[model samples]
Target: MKIGVLTIGAELLNGARIDTNSNWISKTVIDHGGMVEFNISTKDNQSSIIKALDFLLDQSIDMIIMTGGLGPTHDDITAKTLFEYFDDIPILDEKYWNFLVSRFKKKGFKVSALNKTLALKPSNGKIIDNPIGTARGLHFSSNKKEIIALPGVPSEMKSMMREATLPMIKKISQKSIHSSILRTTGITESSLYEKLFSLIKQAPDVELAFLPSLFGVDLRTSSTDNDKFSNFLMQVKILLDEFIYSDKNLELEEVVVNLLNNHNLTVATAESCTGGLIGDRITNTSGASKVFKGGIIAYSNEIKINQLGVKKETIQKFGAVSIETASEMAAGVQKLFSTDIGISSTGIAGPLGGNKDKPVGLVYIAISINGVTTVYKNNFKSNRKNNKRITSQVALNLVRKELLKF
Candidate 1:
């Protein structure tokens, strides 16, 4: 089934608010074995909404999911527009009005005139209750196209989608879709696609999608039958095991924590330019205390020497961003925390910090695992925040690689 999504709001069109509804709807449709063929964003104007709806209907889409403009305020015109488009008169839904009144009364507040707008519904449309907010969703079936209108607020929209929209879609769409996602690191999207293109083509029933981010590349495979999809995913995993970091929906930090726990090992970190970000990532995972001992933020040369026990002479000779300082920091943290592994990062995440030889985005990462120390140097050209994020990702990837070697 092909689905069309329309996100409505002047704020969204003006970039005042991000349209996350489209992303949610897309993922939901894909997971339910439906495909999204068209997406549009429009302001909260009647003509604009009508135009978008006409265009989508002309495409002969099976379903249209619209988010926004279902509020009680004056700008909320989606319900009125749908009423006009269907040529249906607006009628007050007594049950919905009572529900709204009960909600306001429960909050120790009286229902105002503006709140009554939420009780208006198209004469021929069915009401989809919004449990989280005042505005109720409208379900209209006109011209053989199903339109599901939802509130603009993310929380209410998401709640209505999960509680009402998804079940209706599943009942109408008879296809059963199965999907699995494989997460990988230390490989580029092009390289990973090239390696798996032949296998993907051979399995025509299975649809493959590649999602790339700074952490890694995600491979999502979907098929009609559960058994076939499971078998295909197993085959793909066997073929790409070397490059696959996680096949069980685990993040990079979670994978590292599991590996360390399995080996009965503990880890500590000393960070400079990353500013405790590496430590933060590791500890963000649940049960991190089982493997994560602690970390130190050695941002200054004095702190690197005095706190992490980096040699003063080493920093004077090779600088803080050098391999020598990174290695020492790793080794010192490992000894201080009495952990089986230690990681360290020192970088120049730059808008200003750079030299002729050591330019901006110069990062040095070191990991000490089981008496072996490995250091890597990376030069990333991006904004300061992006550089820091990439540095943290690279550090985690390095630790993941080292753990795999065990």
Candidate 2:
């Protein structure tokens, strides 16, 4: 089935707010074995929305998922537009009105007359319950084409879709889909794409997509046939073995935690430029306490010397961003926490604070695992946030590599 997603909001068209609904709907539909042929974002104007709907209808799309303009305010015209589209009279749903009143009363607030507008629906449309918000969704069918209208608020729309809309769609069109995601780091998107281009082109039965973000790139493949999809995934896995960080939907932190747990090892961290971000990542995973002992934010030279016991002479000789300081920090944290592994990061991530030899984005990372210590230096070229993010990813990747070797 081909689905068309339409997001309605002046804010989205004006770039004031991103149209996240389209992305969510597309992913949901594709995961359900449906194809999203096109996606569009439009203003709250009636004529524009009508034209967009006409276009989609003309394209013979099987279904249309529209989000936005379902508030009680004056700008909320989606309900009215649907009425016009169906050529039906607008009627006040007394049950919905009483429910709204009850909700407001429960909140210890009197229901204003404006709130009554939310109870209005198209005469021929079926009301889809919204447990989270006032804007009740609508379902309209014409000539075997279905249109599902949802509120603009992300949380409300998501809840309604997941609880009500998705089930209906699945029942009407019983189909299954399978998808797999491969997480990778330590390589550029261009490099990865260049290497996988031929395989992707040859795999006509599978759909491939790349999602790039601050952490790394995620390669997603989807297919309608379950067994065929599994086989295709295995082929891709064999094609990219060492470069694939995760094959079972695990995040970098989760992978690191699992590795540590499997090896019966514990870890500690000493963070400087990342400001305990590395530690935060590790601890964010569930059950991290099993493998993570503790961490310290040795941001200053004094803290490095007094807390982590980094030698003053080493800092004086090689500076804070040097590998020598990073090595000492890792070793010190390992000793303090008495863990099997210690990780440390020291870098210059900034628009300032750099020298001729050690420029911004210069980071030194060290890992001490099983009495063996290794240090790496990276010179990244990006903004401060990007540098910090890349530093964290690299640190996690290094731990993953060591764990694999063991």
Candidate 3:
């Protein structure tokens, strides 16, 4: 089934907020074996909503999924506009209103008249359940086109989509679609394309999408032809095994933590330019406490010398952003924490503090494991934020690769 998405918010167009709903809806539709034909973002006004509705209805889409403006405020006009467009009158649902009253009462709050509006829906519309919020979604079938109106808040929309929208779409969709995403780091989009060009040409039925960001590239492969997809993916994996970190859409940090757990190892971090970002990423995963010993933010030479035990002579000789200092920091943290592995990152993440010999974005990442410390150097070309993020990613990737050796 083909679907069209309508995201209603003036804040999205004015750049005050991003339209994450549209992207989430599109991906969800695709994952559920339905295709998104187009997406239209409109202002939070009656005229814009009517125009957008008219345009989408004129298209050859099977259904429309809309989000935003379903609240108890003046700007929340989606429900009213939709009822008017369908030539329906608002009717109160007494059972839902009672539930709302009990819910508010349990929370020690009084239900205002404005909250009652949430229980009013179009006379002909079917109510879509929203377990997380007061704004209940509505489903209207008019002139053979199905419209599913949902609350704009991301959490509410996602809950409704999974609980109600996906089931509805499944009843109409006839095709079976499957997708797998392979996440890779230390490789550029162009390089991946060049390497996979022949494999891509060999499999014409599979759909391949290259999604790149500051961290890495995600290769999402989807197909309706299951046999052809399996064969093609097996070949791609064999060719790109070294660069591929995960085939289940897991983040690099998650991958590292999983590897550490699988091998029954522990790790600690000593961060410099990246601050505590590396440790933060590692701890973001669940069960990280089992494998993550601890971290030290050695931002200054004194801290590196006193806390992480980096020799002052090494810092004085080769500066802080050097392989020597990074190696010492990694070894020092490993010995201090008494972990199986220790990682460190020292760099000049800067829009400043650069020279001819030691330029901005110059970084040295080290990993100490089994009494051996290995260091890698990179000269990235990005602003401070990006440099810091990329350095952390690279450091995590190093940890991931090292864990694979065991």
Candidate 4:
């Protein structure tokens, strides 16, 4: 089915608000095996909306899904415009109005008179209830095409789309779509493409998209062929065994936390340049308290030496960002917190404070497992926030690799 989406809002055209509704609808359509051929955003003005709607009709769209401008305010004009285009006017839906009044009474809130506007629908349209909001969705089905208009709010739209729209979409569409994401860290996107080149070529039907960020690269693959998708994914896991940290698109920290929980081990961190960011990530994972002991923001040389038991000599000799200091910090944190695993990060994230020998974005991450420690030296190119994020991810991936040993 070739579907076209129209997102109506003056705010979107003026950049006052982002049109997340269009993206959500497009993805939802594809998930139900409907192809979204065109997506256009228009002002809430009646003339602009009419133009957009006519364009979709002229293109012979099988379905036209519209979002926004369904509120009671005068600026919300999508429904009135749509009704006029069909050479008709809206009529009050008395049944829906009664339901709305009853619902409001049941909820113990005085029903606002403005909400009555939501019960008005096109004379020939079908009404879809909105349990989450007051704006009822309007559905118009014709022999040649279907038109569905949903509330602009995300939660309300998502609920109605999944609970109502998707079933109808699936019944009309022939294809079945499935999307999967594989996440990896401690490796470059280019390297992944090089290694998976052969396997990707084997699954010529699967559409693959690479999304890279400060944390890592996510390989998103979508397919309409279930059998081929499963087989192709199995090959991906086999080829990138150690590098594939998450096949279900879980965050790297979440993966590490779960692994540690399974192993019944504990973790702690001693952070320098990252400033307890590693600890923050770990704690963000639910049930992290089961495995995470504590962390120390050993950002200063004095704190590293005094609190984490890092040798004053180590910092003075090799500087605070050196591998030796990082190793000591990891070992010290593990010993201090009595955790099975300890991770540490020391870096120079900067647009300043760089020298020829040790340039900015130099990060040394160390992970100590039961007193044995290993460190990795990395250099990233980005702003301070991104550099810190990369350091935390690398440190977590290092812990993840070590945990795989047991």
Task: Judging by TM-score against the true structure, name the best candidate.
Answer: 3
Candidate 2 vs 4: which has more lDDT:
2
Distance from true position, residue 210, model 3, in Å? Answer: 1.2
- lDDT, each prediction: 0.87, 0.87, 0.92, 0.87
| Highest lDDT model number | 3
lDDT by residue (1-406, candidate 2, tens digit) is 7788999999998889988888888777666557789898889989999999999988867888899987878888888898888897878889989988998999999999987778887778788889878888989998788999999999999999899877766766656668878987777788878888888787788888888877878888898877778877887788777778897768899999988999888999999988988889999998799999999999999999999999999999999999999999999999999999999999999878987899988999999976778999999864888888889889988999999988
- Give the Å shift of residue 379 in candidate 2: 1.3
lDDT of 4 by residue, 194-256 (tens): 988988888889977777776778887778888998888888888788878898768889999
- Give the CA lDDT, 0 to 100, for residue 263 in model 2: 89
lDDT of 4: 0.87
TM of each candidate vs. truth? 0.91, 0.94, 0.98, 0.88
Write model 3 residue lDDT over 1-406, tens digit each, in one string: 8899999999999999999999888777777788899899999999999999999999998899999999989899999999999988999889989999999999999999887789997778888989899899999997688999999999999999999999878888888777788999999999999999999998989999999999999998888998988988898899899999999889999999999999999999999999999999999999799999999999999999999999999999999989999999999999999999999999889989989998998999999997899999999974999999999999999898888989
| Model 1 per-residue lDDT tens digits across residues 106-213 | 999999988877899777888898887778899999777799999988899989988988877777776877877899877889998888888887788888899998
Cand. 2 Cα-lDDT? 0.87
- Candidate 3 backbone collisions, by pair: none
Q: Kindly report the root-mean-square deviation of model 3 from the true structure over all alpha carbons.
A: 1.2
Candidate 3 whole-model C-alpha lDDT, 0 to 1: 0.92
